[model samples]
Target: MSAHIHAQNKTTEMERNVLLIEEQGSFAVGGKRIVKDGNFDLTNPLQPDGQTYHGDHAYVFYQVPPKARKYPLFFLHGAGQSKKTWETTADGREGFQNIFLRKGFGVYLLDQPRRGEAGRSTVEETIKATPDEQFWFTQFRIGNYPDYFPNVQFPKDEASLAQFYRQMTPNTGAFDGKVITDAVSQLFDKIGEGILVTHSQGGGPGWFTAIKNDKVKAVVAYEPYSSFVFPEGELPEPIQSTGLFGALKGVEIPLSDFEKLTKIPIVVYYGDNIAKEPTQVWNKDHWRSGLEMARLWAKAVNKHGGDATVIHLPEIGIHGNTHFPFSDLNNREVADHLAAWLREKSLD
Candidate 1:
């Protein structure tokens, strides 16, 4: 049967009775306590006062099916997003969380430090109201401002677009790779062995977490941004960017630490509308560098005997996908592809 038909059948089976959750809950991990020294006055609410605060943690919401697979999937969202990215899609369809749950896999969705439920931070950062929705719409490859790509898989209705824009959030603290990876490693320690699934900016921390923790059995990254990590001496030259986009640079790690990733299977996926060559357009330019860097990163991994694969959806006959393919209208097809990969890798 064709993949589309197979996906539809799976959806029907899921809605009927397959999606049975035996356990579900939430937790916070890897935070530190801070004590402030001052005098407190009840009469002056705004006056300086001594207090204790706990912050800089990662929050997780998990659901386990009745007969879950051996390895759970821990999902980490990209920058300016939260666990919501794995929940309901903008078009009101079931997101990857439910789809994978129906496939009998435990799903752990995360809200990284200083975002969403984990918004409290050790250091403060101001969040200004930036009117950049249109910019992001294009950056995400849905289309240029006020227009979507022809026959894009994204929901084109106005309401769907509005919902998509509303999902973007601001961080309460500055982005810190160490902080994120530390918390994620702690989470892996708590959860035991599982697959690390990351999107965009989360990919950097995802790699570091795997290096820091032995519990990461595999990795699945979706359109990871500019944070590909390499062994210290094997680092590739930074991919230069055009216009306002910053240069894409590979992060460095000790050769021994980098080899840890080789013990597990790794796959990186990219969506459509990425330029094949250099471009002056900001959105296209940014992703072009990202794509190039991903290939180089994969090559380096394989050179060290690591199993790594890079896939571009359009090259494989899947078309019109945006940056958020996991939440796109054809998401079931996308999920099915991942399911097959998991099975092939014996992770399911």
Candidate 2:
């Protein structure tokens, strides 16, 4: 069936089978306790008080399906997003969380430190009420604000756009890569072996988590934003930006630590609308640099006998996908593609 037809028939006449799960629960991991020392006046409403706070943790919600697969998928979201990114689509369709669960795979969704349910932080940062929704709309490649790209897989209705906008979240503290990776690695320790799935900014910490914890058996990243890591002393020249997004510099890890990535099968995916070459447009340039870096990263991995593949959806005849293909109108098709890859790699 054509992509369009598949999208149009997303909801079928036959009812979806009720999902059966063997286990479901939530947990928080990796936190530090901070003590604020001061004399407390219980009778005074406004008095300096001594208190101990637990902060800097990641929140995870998980479900293990009946007869679950050998490995679970741990989903980490990007900047300005939370675990909700993998739950339900802007159009109200089932998102990747349910999609993968139906395939008998356990799914773990994370709200990284300082974001969403994990908002408690040891350090404080002011969150300004920014009017940047339009900028994000363009950056996400749904289209320039107020206009949807031709035949884009995103839901174009006003309500759906509003829902998407509401999903955007602010960090209560600074985005520290080490903090995120530490928490994720701790999560892996608790969950045991699993596949790490990352989207956009989450890809950076996801990589470090894999290196930090051997429990990460495989990695699947989607449009990883500007966080490619390279071996020490082998870092490539920074990819200069064409617009406001700064130059893309590869992070360097110790060669010994870098080899940990090679032990797992890795796949990177990009959607449509990203320019093949550098462009003055900031939105397109953002992804152009990402695509270019993905290729170079995969090459370096393969050079070290690592298995890595980069997939541009359009190049594979799947078109109109934006940055969030896993929640797009044709998300089932995208999930099918991933399922096929997992089977091919003997990961499923």
Candidate 3:
């Protein structure tokens, strides 16, 4: 699901597209549009009942236009990650934040249930402690590298790390897994309607969130973890060791059950190195979770007669580069490509 590119025509195409989109906003100057004040703020709409505290539950509104669009996007980050990761990290390759904003899609960076937040202690732990949901968040285990367990540790020396592994939840992996999904589902109820942009482990919680709200027009998942499990079958062997492996062990709702809930469309993406081809060995080993998840999504969508596409992220490279080149020499090319992709898709 990835492709690499050169800086020739791709750069030109990206620049041309950016200019074209920018020009569409009559008030843009110096290639930057004069944004109408998007004064959206973060607040705890959900009261501290069982699991959450006064300020523990929060949501951030990003670039909401005064005039809302037909479809907006709500983003939920993975564990130990923040909404800002999308703008700065992820594929370390630039992507579509600008296009989505200019297109008038209201964006909410919901704080999916995570550690370092009070929800873990109050809500997450409490929920999982009940006998009714014992298997809810205790499925996946860490394979191969035992060092990665309690399941929150980053790979020690993964050969080389293109991006830093996000931090770990304080103690329990169960709370870390369940809290985000709960936060996302609840957030959906509050937002009313929108699209979703999710990645990694956020996939499980994200899927549940999307199905909870019929107003969601579409969903784009970046190598969503366990996306392939949606058709409802046995979880793959290797993946069964993760801390959040309950879905595989038959603990929670299956994507099959929520087929009718996806009111609009859904798409998935996985990254690839610019150097090798799709399914290349390096990608499979280095970014195995993403690629495998892409395949799972392919199967899951088709089982429900759902339409989905797996783009080789390298081919869709930001500025025709690969492997999170932000620190490399080709960052500008990557940025331009990312800007262009957002415009092309009319997404942010």
Candidate 4:
């Protein structure tokens, strides 16, 4: 059942079945050593149990068509989410995976290290706690009980909300920039050249990955909370420059790196109601600032000779979209919009 069968087209003769390749592996760095216990009760003398290998576990699922597009698309989910984010919409409609597959592009979905199928890592030692569902409910902009967005698209009933919550994985609020960047870099090493589609927290690591790996042709970030741009000489406020920038671990992106982004196109998408009236209960408090910073960053990238543009969906007549657009009810329409943009860039 993992392999889906479809009718082949006469002209291109693409294979009828959707070939799904599932790969599960761990990328290990550092070394292993043997440690002795004070009470020497060694049942197994050859035990190499003490090891310091901290790296990412990748659950990469590739959906490939016979006549695939020139470049594959890699989907990276944001914090506390899994590769499932790209597979299906919240209302149970198709997601970007099938949409892109129909467009002749292969898709690679990743369960980030220490998440989903990637499971546990020693890095969890650094994490003290995980946020509750209410935190996600408000932060993800789904709703805040009685004060939900006027035209909220997120499923509001208890059953649907429970399903959405199931997609939420436990994550240490702390993210090690180096570890994530390294893992994404490794992914690029495997895929060579492709496009990166990142959501929410995935934005920071996505940018870092594209910069570190020249094989990255473009990036499409949807509500990436981490900002990538700042004034040249001015230090950015925390959210603006607080996260990973390129390969520089846990530091603000340097002005010089702006030039590097010119090699590829960058498009950032922000859903409607970001700062509009009947404001999202959480917008004024948290989301709007990072978005403003993203706009400023986009301006900086364009000025520095990079192809970067930020799109506010509402301005373009696309309305009622939430932070997670790909999973919204009008996801296919949104996908079409992005596909058109990608074609304009000669990426489709």
TM for candidate 3 is 0.54
lDDT of 1 by residue, 1-348 (tens): 697587667656875675778999999998778876886667875754676788999999999986568999999999889999998999899999998998878999999999999998999899899788888898898987777888689987899999998888889999898899989989989989999999999999999998999899999999998678899989898999772568888999899999998889999999888888988777777888999999999999999999999999899988888999899988988998999999899998
Runs in model 4 deviating more than 4 A are 1-54, 126-131, 172-174, 230-251, 276-281
Model 3 CA deviation exceeding 4 Å by range = 1-58, 88-99, 115-120, 123-176, 233-258, 261-263, 274-283, 315-348
lDDT of 1: 0.89
Q: List TM-scores for all candidates, in order.
A: 0.92, 0.92, 0.54, 0.80
> Candidate 4 has which clashing residue pairs, if any?
none
Off by over 4 Å in 2: 1-15, 38-50
For model 2, what is the alpha-carbon lDDT of residue 287?
87
Sort the predicted structures by TM-score, highest score first.
2, 1, 4, 3
Task: Give the best candidate by lDDT.
Answer: 2
> Any runs in candidate 1 off by more than 4 Å, and if so which?
1-12, 37-50
Each candidate's clash count: 0, 0, 24, 0
lDDT of 4 by residue, 1-348 (tens): 323234324212422344333332334322122344444336854554542343355567777765576888989898878888998766676788877777678888887766776655544445435557776666666655446677776666677777787887765324555566667777788778899999988888788887788889999999876546443574444542222231121235666665667779999998865654223344433556557667767776777778998888878988777779898777877898888899899997
Q: Write the per-residue lDDT of candidate 2 for residues 1-348, one digit (tens) a residue.
A: 696465334322111677777999998999788866786667763654675688999999999986577999999999999999999999899999998988778999999999999999989899999799988899999987778889689987899999999998999999998999999999999989999999999999989999999999999999997678899988989888774677888999899988999999999999998888888878788888889889999999989989999999999999999999999999999999999999899998
Alpha-carbon local distance difference test for all models: 0.89, 0.90, 0.44, 0.70
Worst 10 residues of 2 by lDDT: 6-15
Quote model 4's TM-score: 0.80
